[model samples]
Target: MNVRVMNAAVAKTVAPDKPAAAAPAHIAATGLAVDFPLEGRKQRVLNDINIAVPKGSFVSLIGPSGCGKSTLLKVMAGLVTPSEGTMTVAGLSPQEAVNARLIGLVFQEATLLPWKNAIENAAFLLMTADETIKKSEAFDRAAAMLKLVGLDGAEKKSPSQLSGGMRQRVAIARALALDPEVLLMDEPFGALDAITREEMSECLLDIWERTNKTIVLVTHSIDEAVFLSREVHVMGTGPARIIETLPITVPHPRTEESYSDPAFTAAENRLRSLLIESHKKGRR
Candidate 1:
């Protein structure tokens, strides 16, 4: 979209009121460092990492395993405290944002309740003490989100009864039930088969368009990252740092044919080269 080129028009109308606030930055992380105790010694996972996610933007965090991809995400989610640095969801602490029901996380696993139906599972977030999803209105909201993800008819089913991909769709619906300003996805399609993974990625893109929620997705696949994100954040291992922040350039509602587009292929190849370089440097 050449967001910079569209400045005047967007700055005046399009960008603002597109997502949560009037052109407010969705998420911003700066100088983020994560270290944990390991074998009686301190082990640094991420270091000197900085990234900013603009409102209504889709960003993919790609890195080798143990390179602190998930750790950085957790730091943004407020689940793990960073050793140093800062993170914000809509310019607020992740914890405070989460308390205000502004941050939504879609785990790698479904994490749905086996005993509850899709509607019930989505409503469960409302029972939370610190934050609420508004169970009364959550069911309809969840169903609409399901429809957005192309699972309109599956809302009556339970997690145990649904397929892996369908379950993940329900999980996505649950995440959207609260109308979150930012969606944090941790390789939600990593568990699915190849074909299913591609389908789920398309589904996610559809949902992203309908609601315009800012998304930060983590994945190990270059193709997946390139296909789904407007920008890709590639990281290196050993006190993980961002090796690259390549822009996707492709617009939203990407088609299956776009997968074969020259631009898409080029972006995928570039990210692949970066990943290989990371490996050559003794990184995962």
Candidate 2:
């Protein structure tokens, strides 16, 4: 399918800046490491990690289960602090970027409020974060976001009324309502069945193309990483670190048929090989 152009109405609502050829790094980390206390001893979860995600690009991190992918994402979100080196989002420290509302985060579960309807839940963060925003205006902005996420007519539906995929769409709408410059997702579609997972992948690509938001996704599925990312950062465990950065040369507006494209298959195979090799090394 051809990439859908952002309509003027949604364009005005988002007001996204088109990414320049020389777009600066939206998120960067250098020699980043994280440690946690285990049995009164410092356990290193990540080591010597460096990454640079250009503005408006889609990137994915894939690795073995215990390879610290989520932890690296948390460090970028400012939910966790790095024990060493530096991290930045939009040239500011992660915490500062978070304080400025430049970051939006979505996790494995939708985590919507049971009591609130779709629009209410989408507007919740904006209303709470900025006391100056009137509830009506927040709802209006949230309605637009819901529409952007393909949830226009379902605004009145409560979380319980939505399916797993629809609930995740609501969760994404909630994050987008902030109009954040960057979106960090840690396994956002991990809970869904295979077919829904594929559907969500397409939904996400459409959203990314329209919003031009710099996105970093942590996923376990190699096919997903191949299909969605401009570049896949393959990580290794045993003091988890990025071992390879594989660029996906597939042209954008990728469709379901892209799955069978030679480039897609090659990238998937390469990623699978890397993960298998890493697992073997970890066993040694």
Candidate 3:
């Protein structure tokens, strides 16, 4: 598929102007608006929002707290309904796509089943109550995934025995098992130590290169976004909206040495300036 058309999966509220008319998008959303009564209060959490994430691309959504970053992710995941607008996940509604098992999600916490060992936890997603892969197949696949995350020897360990980073790796492995066309990650490394977070970032980049699956990650770390994605969507402080889409031209496999590279520094500075300005305006 054409790269232009391949990247057309967008959230609702985006303009109708198509990126590549000759070859349309694999998935896209239009006029996506999400709102709800706060039970005792009348307030809106998200307004007309728009975004486009292309196939085999990695996009990060970064913004201040309570700006609906996670909520936006939930909408994309089809966990929350848009009060108005339309969203298509691989041309299917969110719930429909999820039921069809076309999506994968990695949350802030590992959320792995405590009782299950690493391999079982990794393949846990592949098994259905009524239908499941044979234990051998699950173990084989799980072992491969664990190996991908550098967790080979720990496959027999329980969640409780694993460190935070290990648990998150297991979570990522589980998500990849589904082979989702689009992976939705909500602050997957927020809880990890800076060192673990950096390690996970490199691991994630390696995995993305290997799988080439489209990923939409929600994170607070500007550096993380710059490091992990091809495009970083910076949102306005609140009434969250896309402020700017900073494309990382710095070639990937970006390493500790590359951090000193001018292109990387410039992109980080540009995003930081935009965010600082947004926060200022938010306060005003």
Candidate 4:
């Protein structure tokens, strides 16, 4: 379907609720930097990065390649330690939040276990991370999560039996099973076809609405960034740092109609301009 048709069809879907009070910041980074040692020299990846994401809000980090968007995400996921400065999730260090199952990460690839069935894959994290969760309970929770992601009848199927979207759904279910307070996704849908990508976007918004998890996404698509995020942070490369943080006021449960809205266009244009300027500076 065309964008307009899709918008009209999905227009009746209920929009997400707005937060009644000011929620506390769930993710905070101050002067964060990352560097790697290469050939007896330090290669800087990020520099003086700072951001604050309020609880239950959805945010996106967007910029050109090599801008450290993914690096910042890994820092928040406890997968990489910052070379300098400090960052926190829910007032706790990233490692602490990760250990408590307060942070969940989804990468570009689904990365499902080939041997495991759908439900098994979804329960993998719960079974391995939390010793207190019994096998049966884990399976039950996984099943519920899979259902939540629109895989109600595919529980017995293996990864090979599923489509690309279904496998990603399993991945998402697995992350949600952790009941994380914050979700960090790095280009999770970058590999999908255009139609499937759109479908997954809708799926994500529904999940976010129901769970109210604080999310920070990294993506190159301006439309995806504007459609899903309440705030879009634009970054620049040369030792990477944020250049602008634009609030998206396009309203909740955005449909195809949203892409044409003035607010969406404005956000997309602003981000594009910032990225172009960043690229120009990098070439200098």
Please report, in order, the local distance difference test score of every candidate based on alpha carbons.
Answer: 0.79, 0.88, 0.78, 0.86
Residue-level lDDT tens digits of model 3 in 1-284 = 23124224423112223332233444465666677678787566776566666777888888877777788889878898887777787778888888888788999989999889999999988775216568788668778889988899999999999999999999999888776788899999999999999999999988999988888899999888988887777777456656556677778678877677787788788778767877787887
The parts of candidate 3 lying over 4 Å away from their true place are: 1-27, 40-42
Misplaced by over 4 Å in model 4 are 1-22
Q: Which candidate is the best by TM-score?
A: 2
* Better candidate number, 3 or 4, judged by lDDT: 4
- Top-scoring candidate (lDDT): 2
Candidates sorted on lDDT, descending: 2, 4, 1, 3
Instruction: Give per-model TM-scores.
Output: 0.88, 0.91, 0.88, 0.91
**Model 4 Cα lDDT, one tens digit per residue, 77-188:** 9999999999999999999998989988888899999999999999999888898899999999999999999999999999999999999999999999988999899999
Instruction: Write model 1 residue lDDT over 97-144, tens digit each, in one string.
Output: 878888889988999988998777866665563344455566777677
Ranking by TM-score: 2, 4, 3, 1
Q: In lDDT terms, how accurate is model 2?
A: 0.88
Going through the candidates in the order shown, the clash numbers are 0, 0, 5, 0
Off by over 4 Å in 2: 1-23
